[model samples]
Target chain A: METLTTPLLIRGRGVVSGRVEGEALVTTQTISGWGGINERDGSIIERRHELVGQSFAGKILVFPGAKGSSGWSAFFHMTRINGVAPAAMLFTRMTTKMALGAVVTRVPAMTDFDADVFTEIRTGDHVVVDADAGTVEVTRR
Target chain B: MHLTDTEKAMRDGAGGEAVAAAMDLLIRYGNALGAERLVETDNVAGAFNASTPSVRKIAENGMAEVFSRLNLDSDKTVEIPQMAARTCQLITGIDDQNWALQGADPQMVQMQRDSEAFVGQRGVNLMATCTPYQVGNVPTFGEHCAWMESSAVIYCNGALGGRTNVEGKESTGAAALTGRIPYWGYHLTENRYGNRHIRVEVPVRSMLDWGLLGYFTGEMVEENIPVLEGQMSGVDLVKLKHFGAAAASSGGVEMYHIPGHTPEARIADEAFGPNRAEDFHVYDAAARKKMYDTLQSAEDRKVDFIMLGCPHNSIEQVGRIAHLLDGKRLHPDVALWVHTPRAIRTVAERSGYVARIEAAGGKVMSDTCPAISRRLPEGVRVIATDSAKQAHYLPAIAKVQGWFGSLEACIEAGLTGTWKGDF
Candidate 1:
């Protein structure tokens, strides 16, 4: 694993505007919002997903993007009502599902990174997403 | 996102409170997608029912509140106007007559009915089934549409050559009022061509076989279009419907090309256009067998309930299922439900298929399925279904052991109260 002594600043386009900091929950696999997640608790429920049985609540969820049914936005919308929504979202791809989900979930979200975000950020990394400024400050362990 | 003068006028409250709220949501959504502008669409299919417990709190105020809050993602409870587009409702929760069997709360059922009364009056056709293409809302080739429901979206793009992204309630709500959706993703012509090539080394003929290929292809090419190359026999609407549903569930595939079968391409080379894709994938016997095993989420052999007609059955599929159940009875420990569109069910009722299915102890339900309703027959631990889409999702959604097979296999399991693995 690569170690960093100082915080790194990465620039990208902001999707949703807000400033939030949280530990990163990174997964290489894409997430499905409808059939793939239990919205009440914000846990991944898809049987084959890499993050199955794990909850992304209160974390900065870093992944490829959304998949599965068009109920994606609604399920993620329910998470906000239940108070288990992610603090921030950093995705690499943009689909209608992810766009609508990030908008309704009302989280600070960014995409179109300057580098491979997966390699730059890791799970358990301290990260601050300033979507209003279109930047991600990452400090690796 | 760049908004035209008319869109800006709508954003500035030119139409009404509801249209303004709809434009506001669409603009925010389009900016999030990094889209250039909004595309015009006279067709919209969406989910607008208020049956789930989460919406009951919102439904207390009225159906307008539900549409404003959940459908348009608006804080202001505006009076929604008649649909500006030709709109329809997708699969909903709660079957009109089988609410008791689904164990649905009477209040929730009433909310759904009230919501229907509200929107149905506003020009939203209550097609009330997932497969709107089966009823009367088939989009013409190259027609741009805004649609919800993964299975139906895939069918529209892959089979009918209609253009759409996988839309949701909020976006579709906006589209219904403004006749506009984000002009991005599959809506663009350049995004419609296939980039991946999948070679089928084995025969993919029957519905089950087509489903297996679809599941495998989806897993292999997630969210990417694939141009299939092989010789297959006897392809029809039912097979393609099953294929697309399984593909969309297992992955996020919205479109695919089956050479002569799909509308877009007549040959594999044409599927890729001038550049011609070079990424090669092969599906053989081992991959087919593995996919078959993967769909069977059930470990136990005892089956208690059998479900058929996911993506809602066509008239021919219902007829074949009726033939399979003729002169037979379901096991004492088993229950069966067959879901189809209400319009088709009306036809089935006239054709005697409903009575034949009911004679075998299966209920012919319309308007919903267990996955969408998140309700099942009481105390079902294991279920068998002919739909690979249902088999893939029901295990996770309902916590039941799922068995995937052909219609004949599902019927046999329902009759015996146990999965024989005969197919």
Candidate 2:
């Protein structure tokens, strides 16, 4: 591991309270909760999506918010059942669909960050999400 | 969130472990949504119990565990109790009555049957359809309901004047037990007013036009409630179903209003409320054509399958299909599937429409569609559908070539095994 200076910190509301550390996968585009994702393997399957064919499993998946169907939570629930769910989640804003997804997935989740998380976090950065404290700490790799 | 004494009692395990678990999940879900309290639900629609791999795993642990994991988001297994409100089960993974034609596995069909039996025993009505309103369980005007399917939710909010958010499976299941949903979103009257105004500039007749218009409008004004102003004189339930289904699929639109057509929107002014409409849009022929182009995934239309009646076909739609395929035989290489609610299918059977369609080598399926069934015949490459919702999702979900067109075009493709329409 490289020597790190002061790690960047951001704050948001803790929708689901927990602490997790994982590599971050950030996207500015909203992800569909239904057919947009592959529940069996945790891959973004929505055609032409920026993160198409990328797996968010065991990573800190960050996005603007959820788009598409109310069936979003059901597919996410299948991910949890398959043990392919992300370690944590961060959103710029929260919607009922995403909130219900986070709750059922039981992952450390936060939304409404004070800063633009999309700009602050990169795909391969090691990140720590402390939802109980409403904070995300990023360590650039 | 504030809860009534009875709700509190249920949370405290007074009503048993399952009710308490449900209450706990509801409170957590409400808290996540920043809801202040729970409101009573007069109507509820539960998620269809599918026999997916994950669902099968849940079933292995028994009904209690299934209820806990699927509904309560809990690991502790608990017995299910009677639903507190009028509850109906939405479409299942396979047509319970016609599994062989649907190409469903025997073991999976058995599992789904067992699951449905369990829920039915717990006092939930087994409607087994996406269009629950067609087969009873219609929520009247101003009623509070917890509905799971997106199309049904939009129909409930927009057409029937019933208030509901797009409820998830877990939330709807919990609401079935408690007859309560979190008081937020569409439940509030202030949020129901139209925020955008859309003027239809094209000839808006037929189910196909309505579906195309809805797809175009959803793409233009995503997630915003739109009040439409146009010549909507001949608009009926079939058109509304297609429109609302497409809108909900393409965008996160749970509610919309057509002035003088829908229950809530008597006039443009009434729908828009006191505030000035924030945006104005004109849906013209170009927009409709563009949406049609966007939904078609394949250039070569050597269609192998033709699917109709997504969101479940009404009696009139089935009649139309029966009329189109009256004496024509479907191409041997192509399979045609039509879906409708069971009750409507019964009517079609009585009217001899079902026999006419079956005589043409077509199967009328109930309780499931391609999206929910997630099963198409092996080696099938191209699929044609009249539903924009199915056309939008089938490509991504089923990983097949999707061709979207009118019901007549779909029928023509089924007969000739190739797309004959000019795009």
What is each candidate's DockQ, to 2 decimals? 0.89, 0.73
Give the residue spans of candidate 2 off by over 4 A: A1-5, B231-233
- Return the interface RMSD of model 1: 0.7
Per-candidate local distance difference test:
0.92, 0.87
Task: Provide the lDDT at B62 for model 2.
Answer: 80
Per-residue lDDT of B133-179 in model 1, one digit per residue for the tens? Answer: 99999999999999999999999999999999999989999999999
Write down the RMSD of all candidates, one decimal each: 1.5, 1.6
Residue B363, candidate 2: C-alpha displacement in angstroms:
0.7
lDDT tens digits by residue: candidate 1, A12-88: 99999999999999999999887889999999999988889999999999999998889999999999989999999
Candidate 1 clashing pairs? Answer: none
- Per-residue lDDT of candidate 2, residues B271-379 (tens digit): 9886568999998889888988988897777999998999899999999999999998999999998999998999999999999999999989998888888887667
| Residue B248, model 2: Cα distance from true site in angstroms | 0.8
Residue B339's lDDT in candidate 1: 96
Whole-model lDDT, model 2: 0.87
